[model samples]
Target: MKLKTALLASVLTSAAFAAQAQEVNVMSWGGSYAKSQVEAYHKPFTAEFGIKVNSIDADNPATPIKAQVEAGNVSVDVADVEFSDAVRLCDEGLLEPIDQSMLPAAPDGTPAADDFIEGALQDCAVANIVWSTVVSYNSKNVSGTPTTIADFFDTAKFPGKRGLRKSAKATLEMALMGDGVPAGEVYDMLDTDEGVDRAFAVLDRIKGDIVWWEAGAQPPQLLADGEVVMSTAYNGRIFNAAVAENQPLVVMWDGQILDFDLFVIPKGAPNLENAKKFIAFSTGTKPLADQASWISYGPARKSSGALVGLYSDGKTQMAPHMPTAAANLENALVNNFEFWVDKDAELNERFNAWLAN
Candidate 1:
């Protein structure tokens, strides 16, 4: 009887530890982007820490984090989100404040805060990559090559349905850029109601032929299906479709809107310690560099830039494909997270009304 009781107790203790060793759930935008994280972060993390990572997808990771936190049913340990959304959520007390001191410094001994690009670090989030939303078109579908942001709206020159994200953030910036608003002045113009009207006026020119897309994957699929001759897409998606899948898609860097994607721990994550460990490891110089080989997005850390090289295909260089590449930066506009954080509700309301009309 004593032996049997001891055996049962041991069995129960082992089972509890096994259950506690299960995977940490991470939520992110799906498609090739998620695959990049899986290869660069998840697999290595599991091997190193013995804790598995279960990646989940959403249309926008930020949206679900908010819902889960407010309902007090938080499940996601970490999320990859845009700069503006990260800022907005952190402000609303939905995110766990990250301690920058815990971040690993650069190889050269520069602190993480200084090694990261300006605006890459936030109070509650740490940026991982600097990506862009740029104009892309199927070369096979277009009559002539379109070279500029203005060409995206010039239906008379490159006529076909346009694919645009169903959001005000990138879409409004692109609309204003198409209307000949210089990159430097985009935010200033957007600050005024009349400027917002001007942006809508630009969209009105192409609204009749617009096919709205809500997912990052949809833009590439839309172009592939001959539904849209030209679309605005995250640079990494177009790079994957063009390089990996052999699609005849061309990306126009002109008027690209550059922004950061950050890692944030939701306020009440079940595995808070492991989540922080994952963020630190994933955003470190080596892993960030490894991710660049899988996708075209530039790493947020200055130290990681030197380590980036050819794509996973082993032929194409990743630098020129990056949003921060000198050629790509000519007319690029860095997304103003502060502006978005302040005006998101107001602008989105107007945008929805405009879409309804």
Candidate 2:
């Protein structure tokens, strides 16, 4: 009887240890953005559920997710990806469909679907923040202030290397805007070969003076080091550099491209259930708002806006810094995800060819 009792106790102890060892791997764009998620989501989540979270970083999390899913050796459980990548991966059957029922309601009992901003809740992903890619300049590097998208291409006036993302997505949109295409007509214009040529024509004018950056963190570094007078960068990165680090970086919202970063689960994720739980918890009202305090990106939930009051420093008000603020939205272009979902490959190929020549 004593031996049997001891055996049962040992089995239960092993089970508890096994449960404690369970963890979910999350991938995100590195730098301050990933740090924000760690403070706002990962720490609180591990404390609550006793589940460990392995935080990872990449230039673009979506790339590794697709590779891992296709290779059938899935390691990452959750990833932060752009809206277009989420839709494209889902359509490709590379991601698991996320059921909306798993999400928590708002504090006032509003359903998740109703609480999230339009297009925030996707069939296979849940958005966490609304961020933008904007032109930023070092105050000490230039003589006059650049106020418009056209100014970004006017190297004769600015007269320094310009920083641009190496990708075709936002680069093309901004190029068109620089050439005088209205924000509303950018996608419609890009649908044709003539518009494509026009955007490249603008890029050609400054191609000799352009420095291409591939990572989110590189743009601010490029600007601060004076490698480029002005660079297209993620707004939150510029905000952190200018506000937190006391750098002279400035964000120009005139031709900003707004988009969402969402949480998605790759198909065959090793910790599927934990990934779902993490998504539900991290995208909840408070967590979403808490992330905003650490960075200038706006939360995706309508209810979260009221909770976002100050920067983590406690002195800086966050509203005016957000990409969605009224003043910033005057000439802003919300990214057309559907257009990118269809044209990504074709346009990127063209962009790469242009870079080569």
Best by TM-score: 1
lDDT (Cα, tens digit) per residue for candidate 1, span 162-217: 99999999899999999899999999999998999999999999999999999999
lDDT of each: 0.95, 0.96
In candidate 1, stretches whose alpha carbon ends up further than 4 angstroms from where it belongs are 2-7, 10-18
- RMSD to the hidden true structure, all candidates: 1.4, 2.1
TM-score of each: 0.97, 0.96
Instruction: Output the number of the lDDT-best candidate.
Output: 2
Residue pairs clashing in model 1 are: none
For model 2, give the 10-residue run with minimal summed lDDT. 16-25
> Candidate 2, 167: how far from true, in Å?
0.7
lDDT of 2 by residue, 240-350 (tens): 999999999989999999999999999999889999999999999999999999999999999999999989998999999999999999999999999999999999999
